[model samples]
Target: MRDSLRFYLGDELREIRDVDPTLTVLDWLRLSERRLGTKEGCAEGDCGACTVVVGRLTEDSQGGKSVRYEAVNACIRFLATLDGCQLLTVEHLKGPDGALHPVQRALVEHHGSQCGFCTPGFVMSLFALYLNEDRPDERRIDDALAGNLCRCTGYAPIVQAARAMHDLGDRTADRFNDRAATAARLKALADEEILSVGSGDRRFLAPATSAQLAELLLGHPDATIVAGSTDVGLWVTKFQRVLSIVLYTGRVTELRRVADTGDALEIGAGATYSEAAPAIAALYPDFGELIRRIGAEQVRNMGTIGGNIANGSPIGDTPPALIAAGAALRLRRGDATRTLPLEEFFLAYGKQDRRPDEFVEAVILPKPAPGARFRAYKIAKRFDQDISAVCGAFRLSLDESGNVAGIRIAFGGMAGVPKRAAGAEAALIGQPWSEASVHAAMAALKADFTPLSDWRASAGYRAEVAANLLLRFHVETTDPATETRLVGDRRLAHA
Candidate 1:
């Protein structure tokens, strides 16, 4: 299928008529156009070498022109995904009069660049921020450029440039409001084409619909599904996997939705960590912070929940919380769909139970129980943007008498895969809520799974911590030993 592509890189549309649609937008920008401002330090999304902004139409009160926008990594981002989306790159920073955009000008004035290789990526990310916000806070600045890295100079100046950019851009916020006609025209142009990128014998297919996407997948079941490419990109960039037929999900609007039915929360399969973070955090506060720390903002903006789950890394942070929360995954094929327990979706190392035609659709989460004690924790070497040594989730229910009714315990990076501690839960189930009970539950962890020693941690360290986590959970949920408990419910009293 041939699709039309429209992107405003300055004042012109680089409409390539009827090209293969699966090409990386970065490949098109760097190779086809020779813009070169966008770097490719890492072909994966993490390095921010190919950061770009997509100015999609957004609605506001005035509604003259919608100016809402988001920033994404261009390296792994497919060119077909830009069909109807406004493509903003570092090259667009110059005004018609040759004046630099606030971000670029500030970088110039503040000497934010030294070696200059990383400047364009950072500038584009900040420019995306400039187009979106009139006033950006420190946290906002941090969030906007989290995916970018500068090796030449200290990050302080770049951050200062962000502050100055916000101040300068705030003065003309109303003037920059996109004209309604312009936005309407752009939105009208969305999804106008399909382009595939081919290298050697490998082809990446990115169709705009499930039927079209499924046909590509069904025909090529061996094809790798590329959603955000946060991990698989690592396979290509670092481990050097020979990837053919990367089926990108960005054009699948059905996968970007988020819904709440009061009883349950649902997130589309392609919902990036950036897109679904706020809702996921609102439902599970403890887990929200973890999501924030998952890579940087750009990675979060590009990485999808389904991609993280599908990757099946033992260290993936989302699965432990998801498994503990009793979520379900929606999968779709040509015309058929199925839902399965989220925990059951994972089978082994880097493997899932999905059929050849099936791909993840959405993740459904039920409402938390009333007065239920819930918590999720991540133990990492560094506080931010680091992989976890261990991540855990706990949920507890109490009976009318306040005794433990049920519990779910899950952990990542402790075993071969993120798994529920069945033996631990069995020890706590129907047992009195006492120190002895906590000890019993902790001991059960020894029987659950024997952990392995890796570069991040040792087997003994994992086993000991896994068991101790249960006792710690007990102490955290119940009253402290130092504090006297006046429990009218005798069941909760000390033995």
Candidate 2:
């Protein structure tokens, strides 16, 4: 077992030891390294002021190692998660000649910064985009900047800078372009040893393999499992809770994989939304749209579906959609593994069916049937970076005679758990696809859930929106001439 953590801080390898288990990457950057560029606006992951790029080693088609860079909220990210990866901050963007990086240059040229509080975060986000995409559209630009909020300057200038990046031409020859050397360094640092750091009861363990993780969990069942720190980070920052033993799943390479098995799509428990978006989109397009609005690019890049499921938050955007689509979860403890329906995993509000010493292994989603029609709707105050007030997902199949063959309806934020609307499903089954049947199911929703009123929405509002979403889904699916979606309306107008 390695007793210390090693990672790259902009081409320089640093080894860390005897650090607090709950120490955040942002704190270490400003306090220890004295790199003051990354600022902390919200200690939670909501704000992008502390945005930084993390690069992990990935294999290319030719079996050559390359680095995949992703923008993450450093304020919520733990320092221990940086082991065997490259950390790129705002200060690392300059060339050897002190020339500003293309993203930095574009921001300056476009006047994207004012008061300069959020500039570094924006620059880091743009840098990740610059590395991944040659030219990004307005939608992509907007998605990248969604987590970042500029109070003084509007998003117009920042968006201008995002587009201006494409005008800089080919950037493969840039100073930070080459990943071969960094990949090699990271690969050398990678090992099967468990990285155990910190003192006494307060420690962080990052197991390198799934087997190791299972064994560690079996031994230390009380340890908090942190994948992305998108949620757990808040325990320390907002709640001021000190985690004693944190078993990080970020280093378990097997858990980060996404696989297609013909019968089902298997998304590893630690796979980020960014990694699983394509597969989820392929299975259900509406789910893809819902995932896009989960928490902007930064949150999506870091948050995992497994973490979302394991956390068991009723309002979590993915649970309702996953539950409605008949997704199952693979749970692991020691060498034993068990599969359970996703809906059954949530027992109540702030409680899950997960047992001690067990952790989520993967989410298995069966391929949609031939006649399946799936739709997921997320209703929130803001279109981006906002929690859902109510999330509804519907999967309906029609028989040869145009009757409702099978229907699965689920909702989040309507009750204590992300649960299926059993009463509503019963109302729709074997019924003709008509307004009368839709109304019956809509009425049945009231029987299934007695929603609680909160700041995001009232019970009456949620109940009404839930019913309206069903109506909207029916109209879009049944009526060929009717366009209920705004996007569809625009397309029809253009046509």
Candidate 3:
């Protein structure tokens, strides 16, 4: 086992010892290392001023090593999580001759910086995109930059800079282009041994396998299981809570695997949203779109579906969609494993069916049957990087007679938990797929939930929007020519 955490800060290998387990990467950069380019904006993961890129070794199909670079928010990212990876900051983007990188040059030429506080973050994000993509469209650029916020300079110049990146020609000979050496370095750092860091009462344990994690959890039931730390990091930064024992899940390779069977897709509990997005999209496109809007790229890259479900927040966007799609969860405790329906896992607000020593192992999503229609809708104050006021997901199957054979409707932000609209589903089953039937189901929703009035929406507003979303679903599905979604229409027109 290694006592000290070792990682590459740019090209220099650094070893950190005896630090607090909850020390954030941003603080380590500014206070400890004196690398001041990465700024802390929100302290939380919301602002992108603290953006930085992480590169990890991945296996290519040719049985060789490669590196995958992902941009992450540094403010909420814990320093202990940097083990066995390469951390790249804005300081690493310059050449030996002091020439600005292509991303920096494009930003400079297009005047993409104003006030310059957020420029480092934008440059890092663009740098990651530049490394991954040669030429990205406007939509791709928008998605990549969604996590970054520039209050002064409007996004036009930044968008222009993103578009102009490819004109500088291929960067095959760049310093970062040689991933084989980095992959070799990362591989040498990888081991099956556990990582135990910190001192006294504050400690961090990163197990290398699911069995180790299960055993650790069984031994220390009070330890918090942290994967991605998207939500748990906020407890330290925003709420000023001290975590004593953090059992990190990022090192558990078994928990990070995603398997696709012909009948269903099984996503590991530790898989990040970025890892699960393509598989989720292949299974259900609407659910994919919903996942894309859950948070910005940084959040998606650092947040896991398992953590999202395990946290069991009432406003979480994925639960309603998963419940409606008839998803199930696999949980493990010690040597025992159990499965339960996804909706049943959520007992109430700030509560769930998870046991103290047990942890979620995987999420099993059944494939959509033929003649089935699925749709998920999220209503929020802003279109991107915002929490949903109300999230609705519907999966309806039609019989050969053109009637509603079966239906599952679930909603979040409507009740204490992500729950199914049983009354509404009961009203729609065996009924024809028409406006009248949808109205009956919508009316039945009144009995299903009495939503509370919050700052995001009033009780009456949620009720109305819930029913209207169902109506909109019915109209759009029933009429092939109806363009009910304004966002879809606009995106299509732009395309």
- Best-fitting candidate, measured by TM-score? 3
Q: Highest lDDT: give the candidate number.
A: 3
lDDT of 1: 0.75
RMSD of 3: 1.8
TM-score of 3: 0.97
Q: By the TM-score metric, which is better: model 2 or model 3?
A: 3
Residue 123 miss distance in model 2 (angstroms): 0.6
- Arranged by lDDT with the best first, the candidates are 3, 2, 1
Worst 10 residues of 1 by lDDT: 486-495
The CA lDDT at 430 in model 2 is: 95
Per residue, candidate 3 scores C-alpha lDDT tens digits across 456-478 of: 99999999999999998898688
State the lDDT at 483 in candidate 1. 29
Runs of candidate 1 exceeding 4 Å displacement: 3-6, 17-23, 57-68, 109-111, 171-182, 191-202, 239-242, 432-436, 479-495
Q: Estimate, for each residue in 273-364, the C-alpha lDDT of model 2 and write its tens digit.
A: 99899888888888888898888688898899899999999999999999888999999988999999999999989988888899999999
Candidate 1, residues 196-308, lDDT tens digits: the string is 65555666566767667777778878888887876766675567567656677777766776778788889888888877888877877766766887887777877899888
Model 2 vs. true fold: TM: 0.97
